[model samples]
Target: MKADETIVNGVRIGGAETKVGEDIRTIELPSGARAEVRKGYGRDLMRAQRAAANGDASAVVFALIAEVTRVDGHKIVYEDVLEMDLADVMALQAEVIDENFDRPPQRASQASSNPDSQSEH
Candidate 1:
């Protein structure tokens, strides 16, 4: 098989069997390992942006790492990630947050996209 054929990207869990606050995504890493990345709701994008503004990428990486609930469906602690693995974790973190983050104002085309907005008949 070609090298590209082994990789699968953006695999996600659907249906009621999924958990309430956590969103799961699966991807094949550069290392060729399949990881089931779990992320949660309520990630503060403002805070993350602030941390990045401080010019400390490591801070953003660590902060995002905390939101990762598991790897391969097993509980993975922050310590389990090696220094070289920070990039991988960051990518997965983005997936987790992206899966749950709200669509930005510019991205919304309909009032119905915003739950609090009332539509007139």
Candidate 2:
């Protein structure tokens, strides 16, 4: 394989190397395997929740991981995560949950404008 080409899930993708950006982050497992996780949006969360319907919190989290993570540059589905070692899965879960769900909600003022701004009369 050439330096610019990568085989992800047995399919080759050739291009410039991808760098981690504000929207994407990397998680390294104890086994030296790495997962590239992207920040998921509300739709991704809703899809994950639906996929884990009636399942426990862990199931939902796993589904979310599947929704947002790529291992070896390949999308790792829920079943792939399930087949992983416990420690690796836990590492992925922690990173995925922290990146996607654990952050405090952004205040409306923080998102749009200053909280102390006065309204026009």
Candidate 3:
């Protein structure tokens, strides 16, 4: 996959690529852990595109943000395969945009409201 290319549930992700299908599956983690993951489609892709267009990072980053947790007695469970924490990606993209575009510094209030503020400090 390309650096900016992302694949989730066998669906290709990009600014122009959308239309995901219901393709969920169970897979083993690098630690030999297993979990069931769901596949997201159309709506998910549109949201990802909006995020990317709104100075958010590429969809690839979002697609890679997997949820992995170990249950006490049961095997690890993974959900929301196409789900991404938009706040995280937005913050990263904001910083890059600011640096490249040389945008003015944001006020305390604006910075505080930003989920990526923690990284800025």
Off by over 4 Å in 3: 1-23, 53-57, 64-121
Global lDDT scores for all candidate models: 0.51, 0.74, 0.39
Give the lowest summed-lDDT range of ten residues in model 3.
68-77
Candidate 2 accuracy as lDDT: 0.74
Residue 112 in candidate 2, Cα distance off native in Å: 35
The digit string of per-residue lDDT tens for model 3 on 37-91 reads: 3444345445445444554554433432322111122321112323424453344
Clashing pairs in 1: none
The deviation in Å at residue 63 for candidate 3 is 4.0
Off by over 4 Å in 1: 1-22, 43-63, 82-87, 105-121
Compute the lDDT of residue 67 as modeled in candidate 2. 76
Candidate 2, residue 115: CA error in Å?
33
* Model 3 TM: 0.27
Deviation from native of the Cα of residue 32 in model 2, angstroms: 1.5
Determine which window of 10 residues in candidate 2 has minimal summed lDDT: 11-20
What does candidate 2's lDDT look like per residue over 1-121, in tens digits? 6776666445333443344564888878888888888887786677667767787788888888887888887766667878989999889888887887676776776535774566667
Q: For residue 105, give model 3's deviation from the true position in Å.
A: 49
Clashes of each: 0, 0, 0
- The estimated TM-scores of all candidates read 0.43, 0.64, 0.27
Candidate 2, backbone clash total: 0
Off by over 4 Å in 2: 1-22, 104-121
